[model samples]
Target chain A: MARPMGSVRLKKTNPATLAVGVALCIFIIYFLIGPSTSDFSASRKATAAAHHLSPPTSPFRKPTGDKQKPPPVAHYNLNNVTTTPNPLENRENILLLTPMARFYQEYWDNILRLEYPHELITLGFILPRTKEGNDATRELQKRIALTQNQGPEKDRFKSIIILREDIDPPLTSQDEKERHKMENQKARRAAMAKARNSLLYSTLGPATSWILWLDADVVETPPTIIQDLASHDQAITVPNCFQRYWNEEKNEMDERPYDFNNWQDSPTALDLAKKMDPDDILLEGYAEMATFRTLMAYMSRENGRLHEEMPLDGVGGAALLVKADVHRDGAMFPPFAFYNLIETEGFAKMSKRLGWQPVGLPNYKVYHYNE
Target chain B: MARPMGSVRLKKTNPATLAVGVALCIFIIYFLIGPSTSDFSASRKATAAAHHLSPPTSPFRKPTGDKQKPPPVAHYNLNNVTTTPNPLENRENILLLTPMARFYQEYWDNILRLEYPHELITLGFILPRTKEGNDATRELQKRIALTQNQGPEKDRFKSIIILREDIDPPLTSQDEKERHKMENQKARRAAMAKARNSLLYSTLGPATSWILWLDADVVETPPTIIQDLASHDQAITVPNCFQRYWNEEKNEMDERPYDFNNWQDSPTALDLAKKMDPDDILLEGYAEMATFRTLMAYMSRENGRLHEEMPLDGVGGAALLVKADVHRDGAMFPPFAFYNLIETEGFAKMSKRLGWQPVGLPNYKVYHYNE
Candidate 1:
């Protein structure tokens, strides 16, 4: 009888214990509920702005009778015309981009984002889309703002988006049929269309005077590259794009021959060579013929003129440029989506044709990671 | 009076002493007679051989005259209708005689006369004579001997010979004011003549395949050079004849690029080449390009059909070869002594006109010194 009464009393509630429990529950609810509402609201605003980021258009300060003015261009000589908010100083700049490899594998943000005292126009991309396994190449593929900066990465930027074969694309022929070989090749051709088309290049604003396009793997510094893109009123050039590749001969990656030691014993790949000039390189054995490394760069099908024995059409594209408002009648690269070392040929040819010199400047250098 | 008488006696009264002295003198004369006669005869024979050595012609040994005669050539076979002696074992066996730059230096005695077991049919020589203070280039000369003995030092025979202008034969200048200059130039040209017009080459015998004439300042060594030269059975080829010039920047001479690094940035000196190929190398970089090295030893200049450009006018005399007994239809080298490096071209024109070939062997790997 005594035990039964004690159990009953114990089951009943204790006043002091209930009060403490209520206070703890209340504090937990307040802490959790307060921060969440604000965080959600901020995330919604950020998403909305990204979605609203639209390409700009020129406003109408002139009557409908007047012809549409050329898009903002990097123009000089202020006395010729007048307008508010000079595009060269305040407008956004656009750059057409490509991948560093057969695919994209890098972070690119704010490559041409107009910031800091200047406005950016747009970012053009040359993407290779839709490919499957074994069709993939070593290249950079994606473009994204850095997680740390919310804008651009330290040095890498995808000024132009370079899309390669589709990631995880379906394999059409899994039965190991040889007939699929032709289909595989067809897919490759289609993937490169974005880069080959000229429509993308023609879109650069008329107001833009300096157009720069870097590989997807390239990075940018200071978030904005507007100030860095400015150039003198002459042909623009850059030193060789630096890169690091594995060499099988020495069984290691080496900088001695390519990045160091200076190329020696190489042949002059050109047909019109002269005796070694007094100012030319110093060397030991001609057996190695290393000097031809540069000539190989020049005589390539992509970098130079269509000489009788040579078919090269351009130069390297690792880091390339052109004056936006340059008055040359034709200033476009060949309409080929892919070329072997022919990017710089376009600049070299146009320069030669126009009697303007395209000289590589010592100070103009780029460290390209040519994996 | 006594002194005068004594002096007269000393002069006149020596009959008894004279008889004794005469007898002693007669004995000595008798003792030396055999050796003195032998020395006189030997000297006369040597002088005659030096000035008037000629090939032995076998009229009775002609195949038509003898039913059983030794084959026209020993070890003759269709497989080797023509052959080039090995460079090592046959260094002196196959002679290349040319007055490139080493011929002018004065030597107390010539090595060819000392080392060889056989009478050296040394056929090439730079002409004219020289003394002190004539032509500032006098000191830049050497002596070379191309002989029948194959040996290491056989190639040391190339040298510049400064011809003596003040000779009875006379060297008239086309320009009176430039007589001295013209004379100096004439000497060099004459040296070239010794190479192009030599009887020894004519007598290498009809069975012989080629004659290689090299310049003085070249550098080379390899045990297999002879085998390599013999390997290329073409009608005309030149052993390597690289040209070396001072590079101001590197402060040393370097071989021109062959791999195209700078697109023929440096050229081979024109004088360095003696090509028999139909192509016009003049339009290319013959100035410092290494493609023109003097390693030639090929078919005689009788292969008229081999050359087209400049028509095998004849090959440069620097490093040349000819098919033995292939009658020459081409003109010989120019009457002038030397025109920088034009000797090869001069001979080529002559060969082309006459329908012969002047071949070069690029594999011979000969390097000329840097002046």
Candidate 2:
């Protein structure tokens, strides 16, 4: 039998070629599952929960049988009342929490313009996971350094905390544009809920007396906003939000779209809430509702003249302030629908479940940036 | 001639192998000189300079002859004389600059303990390029976030800034330890001068009235240190630096290793300066000196009892405050020897050359941390 010399040579080369092929496979595998990969497994959630500052039992623990009593309607003032300024000795320590994705310079400029004492205002920023967000955060950091280094203006921020990480976006296909928009609404809300909860859980300290949740897009607010909110001394309080849009037809400054999240319980809303499945969500602008049940924006011109105090069943995150004790007692932003509501509305519901009333200021309005 | 079939096959394989080898070389080259490489070239320097807030100019500009008149001997009080507090309208903004390689928590804690109003103070930190330094800086950032989120004590900082980058180490060889030590000392001083100048160039703004250089290792200082220094109204002022060493034999706290940089132009020092080449550097603690010629530690008991003001030819970064106008007028920390001194001492020379006297608080001391 003739020796198969070519076969012998091929066999010798096989191991070397096989090794190269194996390395290529390994490289591809690593690239597929690297640090950039997103993981939302139960183990990861447990890990996140374990890192919380407070001992985690159940984030939404009911206040036992004694607390089953219905919460009384809350009333808060929106008029430009001369808020009794507390003496320096008894100044409340306010931790301002802002979940932001953009507008670094304007936010800092507004913060610099705040009339409150820097010694008492702790600024905390939670940045989302996006190139835009990261860039904005870096810009803010440089500004902070610049102001601290050479700005003649006093750097009056009591303390500053900035946390940045990626927040997952809603899953959508390019082909289904309409579905994408609808799904994105819920997805963005869910992502925001996660961001807010993570920030509050990780950063909230025992020394904080109040927590102020301010949206990044709200550009103009009175310097005394913090003081005014704190003076109410309520479980939860939110100011009316109005957008500042250029009146295209009139060629002058005009109020634009307003936030309608601040609302009182209406029969139509209650009926809509009842019709939805327990796991289904009820969105504000998407839900079918009568004109009377739909909560409309509080116009700027009508501010400081309406009812000083009003009951609010649901409130938006534009400018909400809550006593630290309310959160410490176990209230959180429920990401999923707890009672046909989700996100901030769910948070309001959770707060009331613990016997804390939710109050809204109809007349006191903060200006939102035109989108 | 008979065709060599095996040789023909070998030739074809060789070309393929050569092509693979060339491809490997190109890949390795790209990886080796990629974006992650640390470069200290003129281009990189230009890039760094470009990032500066102010227009780039020679950092070490000499004052013209008309400004050569020796500044009038400055007199400042260090005694706790009932200082007249400036009214809110007249309050001068102070920028506290601390270039640190370590000690994040202590620096912030000490900063929080400062008695100055947060509205008037701006905190700036420059961290060196080292693994330890970077880690400490990250820890400080986390602590800042934590304190603002959770700390019960009021956040008292007006504004905070942190800068991070690698500074080149002094050139040295392992063969010569003694020479390495000497060269390293000069190198470190030069490096510190560069860092200080860069920070000042990037952060200094028109609003700043004063720049305070405080070392991170200073663990204890009078709460009213800023007020006391600002009250002097000198072009440049430094506090006496005394290290609290564990007195092993005495079993009590004792000041050992005092900062000798703060000094008068003694005949011995002036004579030494004259002998050295203009390019050579003069170091503290190395030159021969008598007890009186060397300015030693100002004992706590001796504080507020010595000459309220003493002429200082040089000062340490431990605690030096300079009027903003001096920096605005082009005074800088010269990295090279000027009058046979460099860094902080060179800075003193630069300031003096511009008709600004350097003042020393012989009776006021700030405690250095026990290393």
RMSD of 2: 32.4
Please estimate how well model 2 matches the true structure, expressed as its whole-model Cα lDDT: 0.51
The regions of model 1 sitting more than 4 angstroms off are A1-96, A99-118, A132-202, A219-233, A244-268, A272-314, A326-328, A335-343, B1-371
lDDT of 2 by residue, B1-371 (tens): 12232232222111100100000000000000001111211111212111111111111111245533211111111111111234123555566877666664565677777776544555555565456555666776676555433443334343444544343332223232333244545555655665665455434432355778887777677877877777776888788887666788999977643566677667867787778776678776542322134453332244366437777877777788787646543456655565677778877876785568998877787866654
Per-residue lDDT over B1-371 for candidate 1, one digit per residue giving the tens place of the 0 to 100 score: 01122222122221111100000000000000000111211121111111011101100111234343221110111112233444234322333443322322222122332232122222332222222212322333212211211223332222111211122233332332232232333343433342333222222221123444544433332334334454454334444344445678999966531100001111243444344332122312222234332212222133433222121322443344443322111123433311222234544543332234544433344444333
Interface RMSD of each: 51.0, 31.8
After superposition, which runs of candidate 2 have C-alpha atoms over 4 Å from their true positions?
Answer: A1-89, A168-180, A287-296, A299-303, B1-371
**Candidate 2 local lDDT, A240-322, one digit each (tens):** 87766678899998764366666776787778777877566766544233323324244224426543667677778878888
Interface RMSD of 1: 51.0
Under CAPRI classification, how is model 1 graded?
Answer: incorrect
The sequence of per-residue lDDT tens digits that candidate 1 reaches over residues A5-87 is 12221222111111010000000000000001122211212111000011111111112344532212110111111111232
Q: Name the TM-score of candidate 1.
A: 0.27
